[model samples]
Target: MSSQAEHPKTSSSPVQNSIPASSCPQKRTFSACDLNCKTIENKIRKKIKHSWKRILKVCKEKDISNVGEIPVSDFLDIAGKFNLDLSEGESNQITAKYDSKKNGTFAYYDFLQSCVLFLKPKETSLMKRVIIQKPQKPLSPGPQTTSFFSATLRIQPKILHCWRPMERTFKSHDETRSGLLNVSDFKQVLHDYNIDLAEEDLFNILEYYDKNLTSKISYYDFLQAFIQ
Candidate 1:
C-alpha cells in the first residue's frame, strides 16, 4: 500500500527514432555518363568564350555580306581552325541542334546571341530574340544546276566514306600544289575517280563552291564540305 504506483513505461514512437526527411541525402538523378558529358560541354563552352574574338573575326571573314549566316562546312572549319577540337559527333550534334532553318546553313550571329547567356551569364540583356529572316530563294536551277544537284547528292555520301583516298586523289591532281584545282583539272580528277559527272555539272559544282566566282576551286574546301 505504501509503494507508489509504478510509472507507466513510456514507449518511444517510431517517428522519433527515424531521421528527419529534410536531413536525408537526396538520390542522384545524373549518371556518370551524364556527368562526363556535362563536363565536356562545359569545357567546350569555356574554349569557345576564350576564342571569342578569333571566332568573330573568322565569322566576319566568311560572312562577307554581313548576313550573319555561313555554310555548315565553314562553321566546322572555323571550329577546327581555332582548335576547338570538337569531335565529328559533337559537331554534328551542334549543327543539328542549331540549324533552325534546316537549310544546310546556320545563323551564326543568332547562335552567338543564344550562347551569350551561357557564355556570360551576367549579360542577361544580351539574350534578345533574333528574328531570323528566311534566306532568299536561290534562282531556278538550269539544266547544269540540276545535274550538279543530282551529282552532289550521289557523290557526297561516297566522299564521306572515302575521304582520305579521295583527298589523296585531289592532291595528286593539283599540279600547282596550291590546294586548288581549275575546272578542267577537277573534271579530269572526277573522271579518273570514275565519278562520271558532266561538264555542266562540274561547272555548277564549281559555281556553288566558288562563293566569289574566283574561277578556281579550292578542292580542300570542296572536300571539307562533303566530308562534314
Candidate 2:
C-alpha cells in the first residue's frame, strides 16, 4: 500500500512543474502590462504639467482672481483656448462635476481634469503631442457668423457670464464709438482689467486679433479672440 501511494504522488511532480512553467509567462505578461501602465501614467503627468502652465498663463492674461483656479464663468474662455466645441450645457456640467469645492472656481487639478475628462489612457498619448494652431484670419461677419456669436445671453445665460461685463468694458474703452479699439486703448483696457503683461506679450495678443495687422481691433475682434 505504501509503495502504491508513493508511486501516485511521484507521477504528479511533472504536472506540477509544468504548471509553474506556464505561470512564468503569465508573470512576464503582468510585468509587461505594469510597464505599459507606468509609461501611460508618465505621459498623463507630462500633459498635466503643460496644461497647468497654460492655465496660469491664461489666468494671468485675463487677470482672473485665483491664479490656479478657474471660475465657471470662464469656461468659454477655457473652451476656446483648448479648441473645445462644447455647448453651454456641456460646459456647465463639466464645471459642476470637477468643481468639488463649489466655490465658483475649479482648483488647478480640477481644471486639468476638465481638460482631459473625456480622454482615456490611450487617448492621452495623442493629446501629449498636440500642436497649437495658429490664429486664423478673422472672417467677415456674415449671417452664419452673426448667428454663431449673436448675443447668447438670453439663450445660454450661464455660459456667457462675462458677456455683459465684456460689453460694458468694451464700450467704456471704445470712446470714439467706432466699435473698435486702437493699441493704446486696448492696452489701457487690459490694464483696467488688471492684466499686467509685458509690452511684447501685449503686442502678440493684439496681433492675434488684428489679423489685418491693422493695429486696431473691433468689438467683434475682441469677441472672437477672447470671448468666443
**Cα RMSD for candidates in order:** 31.0, 28.5
C-alpha lDDT score of every prediction, in listed order: 0.51, 0.41
List, residue by residue over 1-228, the lDDT tens digit for candidate 1: 111111112243111121111111124233543344345456576575556556766887897765556888999988888787888866765655445456666556544433322211121222123111111332222222322333454565456566667667777666556666666666666676677764545545654555455455666555543421
In model 1, which regions exceed 4 Å deviation? Answer: 1-149
Worst 10 residues of 2 by lDDT: 15-24
What would the C-alpha RMSD of candidate 2 be, to one decimal place? 28.5
Deviating ranges (above 4 Å) for candidate 2: 1-163
Task: Compare the candidates by TM-score and give the number of the best one.
Answer: 1
On a 0 to 100 scale, what is the lDDT of residue 114 in model 2?
Answer: 26
The TM-score that candidate 2 achieves is 0.31
In candidate 1, which residue pairs get closer than 3 Å at backbone N, Cα or C atoms, i.e. clash? Answer: none
RMSD over all Cα atoms, model 1: 31.0
